[model samples]
Target: MPLPTGPVIGIMMDNLKKRKSVFPISGRKAVKWSQKLEIPVGGETVLYTGSMYQLLPYMIAAVNRMGKMEDSFLGQYVGLGRFFNKMFNVSSIMFRPKRADHKRFRRIIRDIARLLQQAGVDFGYLYKKELYAGALAFDLGVDETFVAHAQRLSNLFKAQGVRSLITIDPHTTNVLRSVYPTIIDGFDIEVKSYLEVLAENDTLRPINKVEGEITIHDSCVYARYEDVVEQPRQLLRRAGYTVKEPKNNRNLTHCCGGPIESLFPSMAHQIGGKRVQQLKDAQGKGVATMCPICMATLQQAANGDLEIDDIASFLAKAFCPPGANDKSAEEKRSQP
Candidate 1:
């Protein structure tokens, strides 16, 4: 049976066009991770999430449901789903991620922010004003929609007085740093991945001194398009962990099968599983992913056979003091 690529992508583009996010997530939910951190409204340089991490749990849930629908008799209804999605948010109905999943991804975002703060990087958050980078629209080649969205984002930056961006993920970093400039006239935001910022900062050394070996799963956009290959490895090595390289690493990194997961879920899982095997061959304590999609996709493929985490989590564990800025620990402490 043919995958419902057109309908799936159509739904995503519609969401991007209408909601300003790839998923039906509200701006408050998108920016919730930064609330406790008390990040300022705007600054010369801002921490741009692009809603990638916040949207991941929702994306993962939607893809899981889509995979089942595609493999079963329900595949035929996808077109109808897309149609209903236009009138009403069918995605919110069909793709409700688990509470634990939501918390995990949110924690990753907080960890990233905490790591940046620990590194002494002065950055602000746009909060509700930050928009998704239209990565899926660009990846799916929806040029008209993507360009309009990019321009909208550029205008937001211009209005917010944002001169630079510290992006959290590879797709967002690549789009803002590379793609937006090509499409939007006078798009002059200086974008750098948080990894690059931390790697370049000499004062951001690890205080905890973690001991272990972790395999690095390089994001394709980061490694190939943005030259972000070395920054993550450098950060990990600086934290006292032996960086293990899979067979396909750095510029030659294999895809985590996430870009196509929405349209071809099972196929994406298959590709992710293969990549998981390659990482396992490296015989590390765990796998560290720089992209939320990579972490989610490879985790689904690993399914307890391997431990996978976002790179920020490891960095936070090494860089942050015990219980400092730890939301989960605070929550537990407040739980009675």
Candidate 2:
């Protein structure tokens, strides 16, 4: 079904008007925690927050809007005119939006940090300084807002002396690595996905091990656009899972139906369901996703029939080991 055009545009405009994001709460909390710990933020290496943590909220709001619309006059009128080309597009059942699994996003952030620590790649997170990368704005064809956001983000990074950025997700990575350069003159900043950065340091070893056959879902933007197909797989293999390839893998990978989710949820679901079935056809023990949007979209489409995990989470579990926790050895050992 075509997405509810009116509502999607409204949400985008709302996001622009807010000048932040509809889902800044989580990242704001993370920033607060970093401040409490006196963690020095913003230097040569900055941890890019982007919209990975906020993706769930966008999905939640969109799904919620669809729900509220179902019982309104629009739904009744749309049904009455069933003969129209847009008929049968009145239901939000396609997206059984869960409680917006934010805990998972937090875990993904921590996992990235731990992985970086193991790789001996020191970085600082901006926390409060981090801004949404405006990937959604770019994707929705809202160029004016996106360019303005990009300029502001560039200025923020430049002021912070951030020479390099470790992006958390493909969308951010693509926006920073590919899109920004085209629009923002002198966009001299270096952007690397956490996967690319981690992959560069071969000495990084997993302190723990996990056993499973994981089927990988490649992010369309990462794979096709940024050529980030190998870094994730390399990390997963290093984590000790037997990597299984679905028929549509690598550059030929199928989308999890996320890119257009905001504008076309029902069609997104149909596409997502088909991709889920494709992953199931591989019959791997679980499905591993490298993008937050992919994880959220597929998890919903799977409806608990399949286990989905962010690749970073799986790698963190493999490398960090149980009992290691997230603590400095000095602090842990000094505690009675």
Could you say which candidate leads in TM-score?
Answer: 1
Error of 2 at 193 (Å): 0.4
TM-scores for all predictions: 0.95, 0.84
Clashing pairs for model 2 are none
Q: What C-alpha lDDT, on a 0 to 100 scale, does residue 254 get in candidate 1?
A: 99
In model 2, which regions exceed 4 Å deviation?
Answer: 1-7, 22-27, 30-39, 67-100, 323-336
**Candidate 2 residue-wise lDDT, 1-336, digit = tens:** 344465555445455545455333445554532332334567798878675664564465555565455555554343333233132222222333333244445556777777787787878877777878888778877788788888998999888889999998988999999999999999988999999998888878877768889999999999999999888888889889989999999999999888777666677778889999999999899888988888878887888788887788788877775553344444223221
Alpha-carbon lDDT, every model: 0.87, 0.73
Q: What RMSD value applies to candidate 2?
A: 7.9
Worst 10 residues of 2 by lDDT: 84-93
Q: What are the per-residue Cα lDDT tens digits for candidate 1 across 1-336?
A: 545778888888888888777798987688777767888889989999998999988998898788888768898888888898999898998999876677788888999988888888898998887888898889889999999999999999998889999999999999899999899888888999999999999999788969899999999999899999888999999988999999999999999999889888888999999999999999999889999999889988988788788899888989987575454654333211
Q: How does candidate 1 score on lDDT? A: 0.87
**For model 1, what is the error of residue 299's alpha carbon versus the real structure, in angstroms, after optimal superposition?**
0.4
